[model samples]
Target: MSDSVTSVEAPEIVVPEGVRLEPERLLDLYWYMLLNRRLEERLVNLYRQGKVIGGVYRSLGQEAESVGTAYALEARDYVSPLIRNLGSILVKGAEPVDILKQYMAKGTGPSRGKDLNIHFGDLSKGFIGPVSMLGDMIPVMAGVALGNRMQGKDSVCLVYIGDGGFSTGASHEGWNFICAQRLPVILVAEDNCYAYSTPTDRQMGNRNMVDRAVGYGCAGVQVDGNDVLRCWHAASEAVSRARSGGGPTLIEVKTYRRKGHAEHDDQRYVPPGELDTWEAKDPVARYERWLLSEEIVDRSQLDQIENRVRAKLDAAVDEAEKAPMPEARTALDGVWSTPRWTAEHPNFHDFAAEIGS
Candidate 1:
């Protein structure tokens, strides 16, 4: 007898104590978030110094979504984080040195001198290409989960996108198929207020992207992207559902873009008041306050975490700079080195099916 329930809905999981997390895990969790935040700041400096020749989508104030969600996934799970979700990558064990190397165009980068930041996939760690093109990878994520199900593997597929990507027809198509097939894919929508310069209000008809999930026979939840605990809870539930063949869940994280969208955007249109409001709710600060109130950690401990993160960030920069640039010929390398895109597509099933078949 097999425990397979055919329903077009998200699977539910009772939050186990192990996964529920407690103050006992505070130091680890706090440091992880701090480490990622400090890294983002340090990388931005690298970007400015021209050490990072490519570009970056800095999630300056949105650290909670990345670190919290990353903690929920098993080491073997697959994550299709968007460009802005690099924090998620870092949490999935992508080394800062390697990340900096990619930014520096180093040969040892996970992309192997191919993808310079955007296109990302690391088999060893199970985190795949950020795949910048929105809606492109949502269905692909579902397909990965489907393959895992067929192979009797417990891996779950997570797809990440932004507010801008949601406007595309692909979001609709991807969710529809995921529902009909009941694949285990989690779509994390980090609504960072602005998609480039256009505010969410200006870009989309409805402010809440989470509401759209209901139409597709899927479940979606809106959580405070800056609230680490909330993010962890939501993602953990989604992970449980997917692994149990519950199907896909969409999580719309309400957060703000603390950076200028990308390295190039000036973001001059942003009003000062709006920026100040979000800045006050900075996830790091919120989490720290919670830690203090709960006595999970104290000021000295928090300070130590900050100092350590800064040191690591500094070391990553040093390592990145000492790293060699990808060979001068490497400029042409990223787009075509792999035959995955060159081959004729078979029916989109496994990633191999989508490409090699």
Candidate 2:
């Protein structure tokens, strides 16, 4: 496990033969990653100020995995993002202001102040909000893919699970079910070194999680999660395969969680210098270096992109601060639904219209 934390530079960016990204799309990836980082930084500040309703999960080193994978999906495809996957949701059309409001527990949030952090989902945007229980979204996403196939829609579902979450029975059951049914679902196994404080070696016998794909009789591939373009390449292929009825694919994304499980965690269990080592391979920084080295964006262009992201975050923070909280009277508003109430409130007829409902 010590080798996993060794100091290493980012891998060279290699574009697969069939994978082509225009300059505009490349810049878009960089922008989304920057936005993801800046937004989390704002959330950390809000958490310290006591403005946040719950813990803030930071994807400090793993931004590329979320952003790149989701970028490969079409607008019609679906994704189920975990707490650390705020970048994926952003790519799926979630607004920065809504994320801020959700963290601040403002009434204007996607969850209407009912949930905190990125626990809110927008079905219309093709994303399903995650549940607290790890691996639960696996079965749920399987059902989603099945439903899409039944409806004769050529859509795929991408579900993310952590190194630890992969150990759960729910994940196994869902993986088996999807493989047997030949469902159009891509399972992303995030091997981010630790599950809370437990290292990968302590939790599972197989260090390489992607190997399980063979047992499930599905295609699988392993990629450096830090390499944004590589992740995009692999995911794009997986999406194409699933869309073409090739069944499920397991993508093992090798990454590291630079931050603790949450803001409150000090990560005392992490070995000395481990975080620093991973810091050298920071995904966002690596991608920026690639962009600059390849002359994809000059320094001035990068600066402009950073400035735009910061300005958006500033406005989002201000709006979230000014937004009101949920009223006590509305506590039970969405708790239950009756035919009479649905008829009385025509606007609330489609509960799916509400994000994360």
Candidate 3:
């Protein structure tokens, strides 16, 4: 979009030390990243058609970080993603049709039309829904890790926060508590160049976010967020350390937010050449190039993956479009204590039957 765009050289893919991913796992990462991109594209179309109930927040150029990091976690680990980390949700086993239905506010969606966008999560799938209050999820995820420790489980929690969100008092407080208790949690701070219209320089005095990790008494590392392999490597090491009783690790993923804050925003605040610069480092395309160059996947294989992603998204969109909206009477169903709640949590509401009698 800039008049004087500079040609940026793509970085070489160097696999990190002490981390290894099989060819099958590499292809899986590509699948999830492609799925994330295609799904968001479909949502954008639905939004333009006036079908989406809320704004579309895309992770367009940052797919690698989301997919790669979440892929590193085991099934027992918990991930609390932010709005732009939809790729992580897909990696954590969320269905594309369910995400489409949620955006369309269909009754069949995860939240049963009570919420919109990536606002619903399945705890059984090891992911917590994004909190609108930004850094509030830090403390919440710390609690999750604490609960796992209390239950004598080896599970850890990975919580994502933007560079701007990391400056919040809540984030500082939560990190302090996590450090104090030596909780098993991984904090991913996405340095996506800008926060809304404000640049990172204006948001905080310390440009390097990972440096704050030392003040909090934890391990920290910064990685190129556009590199899928690097993201996976960094996250894997952190997960391993946390699972082995090591305290928290702060991972600062250097990336860029190519899209606007939401579909409605024009992103006029961005510098003239900034978008063009980041476009050259597009995560999905870069990863595909690396996969091909390294002989990990053939051109036909990449094409097939793209085709599969498109077909799956097409089906999800069609199914979600035909789904019904929530009925008015069901609005108050989960608003208060009910038989359904008691039935779902018998131990927590043991007096429900007595009250009914």
Candidate 4:
């Protein structure tokens, strides 16, 4: 059988229960999903052309999970995005040009080329930079949530972790701390069925990861990660509950990464017919069909949105390419090692001065 997934007749568009969104709002959701798809596709081209630094991690088949959960956040809320979560960051107000520039390691990028691709964050936009260590950000997000609660703000923090990362020690420790404190946070495990090249079965014995939440003393719900509306509904409920002092919620988003872990991996480990199955249920295509059948958006409108997204992506790439590389001396510009060392042991620096004398 060919590896390509045939686009068979799509399933019916089921409006998520209790969620009432206008047509315009529905179109907005579709726009973000399309934008994410186009942006990642462009990144792949850039990676192949050797324009991007390090490896290009993509959220290709996981757009619905990212966008839907991000859209549920309020402006005051915060999020800790994972490696494959460009859509979530974009929905939180990150400029695509900045994202491209960051990947290209341009002088004007968020980290001024002092960092790896897509590993910087803007706190102004409520996004925390992704750490290469999987599952480490869970505690960071818990701290952010604690800060908000301490300040008397009803804001919640959302953190994304992959199925592979969810098994890490940091994931369990972070959740343990947050649950004990009754912190306002939502944790979404994007179970894409693979931990790098390893399958979930090899990584964890349990079939459904959500069931683990029972031990953590929090509500856990699973969602169809490919269906944007369904994810949005689940996220909306979790966010509402957290903001209202309902403690934490663990949400498992069932999705897949059609591409390799990064551009470097060939994804040969993926079983035959698995990729085809997911490609047929692509979130962007699925949502597009729903919009058309429901008359929420016509073919012309959808095409127009796609054209705009392509143009925007092209412009972002062009601008990032034109941007200059960072100056070498700027590496020392943001270092704060001395201040932290001095604060930790005030007498240690003075002792060093005495020793020099």
Scored against the true structure, residue 6 in model 3 reaches a CA lDDT of 15
Identify the superior model by TM-score, candidate 1 or candidate 4.
4
Query: Candidate 4: which stretches are off by over 4 Å?
Result: 1-12, 338-357
Please write out the lDDT profile of model 1 over residues 187-213, one tens digit for every residue: 888788888888899978888777777
Better lDDT candidate (2, 4): 2
Question: lDDT winner among the candidates?
Answer: 2
TM-score per prediction, in order, is: 0.85, 0.92, 0.92, 0.91
Give a tens-digit lDDT track for model 2, residues 1-357.
211221225465666567676899999999999999999999999899999998999999899999999999999999999999999999999999999999998887888888889998999999998988999999999999989999999999999999999999999999899999999999989999999999999989999888888799999888888888878888998999999999999999889999999999999999999988888888888888888898988999999999999888899889889999987645556654543435346445454366335
Q: Is 2 or 3 the stronger prediction by lDDT?
A: 2
Each candidate structure's count of clashing pairs: 3, 0, 0, 0
Could you give me the TM-score of model 4 versus the true structure? 0.91
Per residue, candidate 4 scores C-alpha lDDT tens digits across 1-357 of: 111111223354457668887887788888888888888888889989999998888787799999999989988888888888888888889899998898889988999988866688888998989877888999888888888877888988999988899889998999989988889899998888888899988888896678888889888888778888877888898899888888898888888899898989899998799999888889888888888887887899988998999999989999999999987645545655643334246354564676584
lDDT value, candidate 4, whole model:
0.84
The digit string of per-residue lDDT tens for model 3 on 218-272 reads 8888888888888898889889889888888888888899999999989989879
Task: Please report, in order, the local distance difference test score of every candidate based on alpha carbons.
Answer: 0.75, 0.88, 0.87, 0.84
lDDT of model 3, residue 215: 88
